[model samples]
Target: MPKHISLISLLVVCSLWNMPQAVHAQALIPHTLQLDAENLERQGLQLAQEAAQLGQFQQFDLALPRARLASQLAPNNDRVWFLLGGLHLQAQDVDAAMAALEKANSLNPENPDIFFALGSANFQQQKYQAAADHYKQGLKLKPDYREGLFDLGNAYYMLGRLPEAIAQYNKSFSQDQKFWPAINNIGLIKYEQGDIESAMKQWRTSVEIDKQAAEPLLALAVAMYNQGDRQQALSMGEAAIRIDQRYANLDFLKENLWGERLLSDTKIFLELPRIQAALQQSDN
Candidate 1:
């Protein structure tokens, strides 16, 4: 029989394993514009800063008005356009965000960050092909741009090009090893490829990196359960619930664990002792 671990231990381990990345990326964004025309630019810049603060606090409704005013005040400023685009995105106004981001990209074509943001907006709108194109363009402008590479990986994943997605994710992870999303995505691809043990290892690594991240924890639990580790699975599942009880598809996971018992009885039958021997050999 497998070891019987408590749900609490599982939760604690999972939580402790997954940690969030630092806010370095957010710091890279320009909070103020410095145009030669000092007064008008400063006024617009101040409004843009206020809008950014609002957006940061998830006050999208409040942010949009200020962002629009700033854009109106500094119509030619790429930063203003970018802020407006971000506000529109927060409001879930995809069309407006796209228009504003396009203008921003046009104004600052060399700025890979703007292109990455535009690609993200496109991805959110289900424009995977266009998102991929924009991400590729952004990468060309700024090689080793981890965000652009990650978004490109997601675009490829959405398009069902798992191998390409995996490749892009690998590239992104190489640049920023602590990026949890890329690690989780790679585990997902591995799981889909029927490499259960490898997938489990990757998911475990993700959880080790950031236990608070619900996605990888849930995925790891599912993988462990599928491999006939009921107690471990239950623990992981419970940990996921603890992290975010409102996480999407929680019901589905619960149903599988309690109602279906789909994971508990997955057969581990082998045809020959040599096959088992080979498996043990590979483990070694």
Candidate 2:
């Protein structure tokens, strides 16, 4: 799963009276122009906050420009760079995001979040080893960071390190019991390894933990179908699609890391008349 860089808690709340003169300046100013670095940073923080707020409203296109302006106005501020990187990442521009985050990391090596951001950027780009390294460094700075632990598990999974992935996923669960994805992903690993019983158990546990999640429901349904429990399998699959119609999509199923055998079974399951009717009804 990709991650978003969170805003820092230390932003100084500046009123209109305290707004820097540069707030009225061009969106992307020339670096050679004389400007107070401190004032620029303060204004940039405000702009970054606005950008983050826009993201909360799902106004990503509106947010990116503000975040870019913040980075330009406060070129030396690590937080602005991080904000810029996060906006890019949210927009799925991995290369740009990684470049901005690398700058943030260089500006403040002590900040664990920078490493976490870099790890997520690399992960999205399918650079699993690089992601693992960055997540490791972030975990070294803050051992209990559950997001880092969970994502490190994802990186390990992509690298075919099943044991290491499960370990990291378990660590994430220990840190935050509400995080059902960790347990759900462990089921995925188990399924990939052909441990069907254990996979079922893990998926059941995940479903109990988060009934609303579509992944475990769909996974459990697939496992059931593979086991010849057609009625139960269809029921679960229907429930999964009722919760989220995207579960019917073959590409989405594959993206969830379904193995060849399981995916083959799923393709057959999808061809079933009842399953096709359920999907069609959901689409309608």
Candidate 3:
């Protein structure tokens, strides 16, 4: 799972909300009590930083507990809540992720990243409409956010709004031509609409942009095999599987939003003796 949310700076900035009311009046309160509060907040920030480092290494199991504790100690800090939400999302706990993300949004409603994270959580839960809505809200704040546009495209695709999906994908690609996933997904939509030639073109462009992208490469291979280009299809299929063997599985393809037509063709392609040999070779 991709870590959708990022840890913000740990250097605590004093904001008007948390600033002491009166410098003179603060002398009336015990110095030790203020020091303890400061110490606890500092410790919470340190723990949050540790959790973020673990998350970067994809150690979600270790990260989640620390993030949870950090959120408890730094209850007023939106960044702590955001990190907690991201860890839960990586762990596939959609409900927990949503709850933490909503809390983060409440604390800092102006932060577009929090809304984008909420969109991702909604996406995981299959609430495509809500996901799209959240993505739109985020985009309004930061119009050129590449990932947010791609995610909105996915949400639109899931909702059967192909044109809108393509528009969002194009927007994302415009932001960065090297972003192959958006192009790959556009190929998916084209293939589903029976535009094999256009789909192949998009997939080819994706492969040209990022040769390591197995999804578009496998889709192209499957299409080539269906069109009677056996030799090239087998070679391309082998190369794609070498990059990522998971693409050989139809279930994995489905998870990536491969349409029924493409999946049917890929199923047949996967059963070919040469492809089967490739899969076995890859396992070793």
On TM-score, the leading prediction is 3
Off by over 4 Å in 3: 1-30
State the C-alpha lDDT per candidate.
Answer: 0.72, 0.84, 0.90
Candidate 1, 1-284: lDDT as tens digits:
01212533454455456634324323322221223235555677889999999999999988888888788667789999998998888788989999999999889898887888888888887888999998998999998988889889988988988889889989998998799888777877676667767777877888888879877786776667666786766666666656764433435433322112222221121222432353344445
lDDT of 2 at 177: 88
Rank candidates by lDDT, best first.
Answer: 3, 2, 1
Q: How many backbone clashes does candidate 3 have?
A: 0
Candidate 2, residues 1-284, lDDT tens digits: the string is 01111111112233234547645433323331234456667778899999999988878899998999888778888988988898889889999999999999889998999999999999888899999999999999999999999999989999999899999999999998889899988988888788999999999999999898888998899899888898999998888888998877778877776667667767888788888998999889
lDDT winner between candidates 1 and 3: 3
Could you list the CA RMSD of all candidates, in the order they appear?
Answer: 21.5, 9.8, 8.5
Error of 3 at 97 (Å): 0.5
Best by lDDT: 3
| TM-score for each predicted model, relative to the true structure | 0.73, 0.84, 0.89
lDDT of 3 by residue, 1-284 (tens): 01111111111223223655656334534553556567667888999999999999999989998999898778899999999999999889999999999999999999999999999999999999999999999999999999999999999999999999999999999999899999999999999999999999999999999899999999999998888898999999999999999999889888898989999989999999999999999999
